[model samples]
Target: MNISVIGCGYVGTTTALMFCELGYQVVAVEKDSKKLAMLQQGKLPFHEPGIDSLLIKHLHRGSLVFTGDIEEGIAHSKIIYITVGTPSLPDGSSDLSFIEEVSRQIGAAQNDYKAVVIKSTVPLGTVDKVREWIGKAQKRPLPVDLVVNPEFLREGSALYDTMHPDRIVIGSDNPEAAETVKQLFHSMSCPIIVTDCNTAQLIKYTANAFLATKISFINEIGRVCDAYGANIEEVASGVGLDHRIGPHFLRAGIGWGGSCFPKDIAALINMGNNNGINLLIVQSAQQVNQDQIGYFIDRLEGELHGLNNKTVSIYGISFKPETDDIRESPALKVIAEVQRRGGTVAAYDPMVFDKHPELKLPGVRVARNMEDAWKGSDCFFLITEWDQFSKIDWGQVMQEMRTPLVLDGRNVLDARKLRSLGFRYYGIGRKTGIIHE
Candidate 1:
């Protein structure tokens, strides 16, 4: 079987490679000349673990191909997966221009029936709009099946998640279209869900919204735990052990921020507003996440007497570890807030600074390494929990820093150990004072 994937981005590239691994020939289409060239040379435009090796292997074996021509991609396969981006507009609604343009292109180029699978995260009723767009672009009446196949892959472990998905959703008005798309993943052992386009789209949004709600709910509780001098880790462990609430997304930290959660949550809220329904829980979740940065800043401001002229070293830049994606990263928010308060900032990341040397954060100094980030700084703030961060020698950090103050934004550090090393350490909701041994 041959598969064509449009818009070679993070999702598109990963999706194309995934099909190749499943023993299907894949033609990946990219409009960007530079990215397309890089893909042809077996290099990824973005950083994802374990994908580079697979890409190289597939390219060497002639199982996968990259192209700049959309018509070539459209002609290669009966299955066309639209993995283009649907970025959030200022009004919190999705910008569907990319999807619209891609649909028209597919329509104009197709000579026969095509199973047009939309893998992008879009608003409800977009399937009907896509069908209308394709119909208008055609020279004459043609048969095309619109399928909504929302993706649920995480950024860092996208390849793993793609290969081992919890469930595969196929949304189509036509039963044959749904089954045809479903058969593409016949070898995978996950449950296949067949439903209407609207329901499938809602599943994607609802899943992200619920996960965001969980993170916000725990952070809100972490605030109360801080007020009473209680341990949030223990609370989360106890609550998560309830069997119904398995232990995921319950780790209380600064808040959830990434490409998907923030945009999807906002879009979901906008969808509610358009329907005259107020999603109070989701609204509160957004508010809580926004407020969390300020809460952490307030603690830092009080500890340093003021942020004015204070040198604070940020330990990570990406939203999470193992990926260089910084979209809506909490670390950026922290840097901006600290600078806004008249503080000096130095930052370090394992991958981001190296991958994007051209990335310019105004008035911020990028450090060469982790040790360079902490030198002569008044406070050390760890925003992203990269594995190397947890293995740092605190004794060296203690001697090098002008002031031995540590702020663990992700609550990943050993609070008791830091305090024992003559450093004043603070985590989100960890118990303060005497460590009993």
Candidate 2:
């Protein structure tokens, strides 16, 4: 199976490598020469665990090819996966310029029958847009079949998520096109959902929005726990054990962040509006998530009296760990508020410093170590739950800070133990300190 994956970012690069590892001839198509050069030289532009080695293995075996030539990529493959980013715009709608441009390119290059898979997360009926773009670009009807196979990979664990997905969704109005796309994942040993294009796209939006709703639900429940003397962790754990509810994104902290959940929830609400529906549930999810972030900031303000003239240390920058993407990170939002109130902040993440050397947070200093971040810091905000941050010696962090205050935004830390160590600890949806007499 000859395959071409366009827009070699996290999704494209990982998917192309997965296809290559499955012994399919894969070509990663990118327009950025710098990115293409990095791929050609066995270096990935983004940090995804285990993807670099897999790309290197395929490149060494000559099963994977890297190029910036659109014609070469189109001519070499029968299955073209458009894995480009459709980032959310200011109006809460996705920026479809990239998707439209790629569709036109595929149409221009289509001389024979091809399965053009839309792997990017887009609004429903977007496959029709691709079909229309193809027809318009080629002047006559183009020999291209549209497939909706929206990707479900998380940023930090994208490679593993792609390799061992829960199920593969292949949607097309034409049965033949859907089956052809299903065959590409025959070796993956996962259930394939074969449906029409519109359902598939809606499934992506619905799934993401539902997950976001759960997160917001639990975070709001956390607020109740704060008011009452209930422990959210124990309550959530017991609720998750019911098997029907299940525990996935229910760890309730500063709400959902990263690229997917926020955008999808907003898009779903807008979609509901266009269809003349209120979508009260999805709208509450969006509003509650905004409150979820506020919950964290509120905790910080209680600790340091409105954040003015306080020096804080923010531990993680990325929305999640093991990826360099900073989109919709809770840390960024909280830090910006801290800066607004005459606060001085220093931040550090081992991964962000490695890839983006020029990454700067305005009104904040980038620190090199836990000590550096805590040297004169008044408080600490634990944002992304990176493994390194989890393994940090809290005793030392307590010793180094100007004030021994720590906020667990991810809810991964043991607040009681920190309090036992003579440090003031705070957790979202929890009481101000440990429940001690």
- TM-score of every model versus the real structure: 0.98, 0.97
| Model 1 global lDDT (CA atoms, 0 to 1) | 0.92
Q: Which pairs of residues have clashing backbones in candidate 2? A: none
Clashes per model (N, Cα, C within 3 A): 0, 0
lDDT of 2 by residue, 265-332 (tens): 87777777778999999999889888776777777777788778789899888888888888898888
- Clash tally for model 1: 0
Worst 10 residues of 2 by lDDT: 428-437
The per-residue C-alpha lDDT of model 2 at residue 83 equals 91
* lDDT of candidate 1 over 232-268, digit per residue (tens): 9999999999999988999998998889999999999
Model 2 lDDT at residue 58: 95
Shift of residue 292 alpha carbon in model 2, Å: 1.9
The Cα local distance difference test for each model comes to 0.92, 0.85
Off by over 4 Å in 2: 431-437
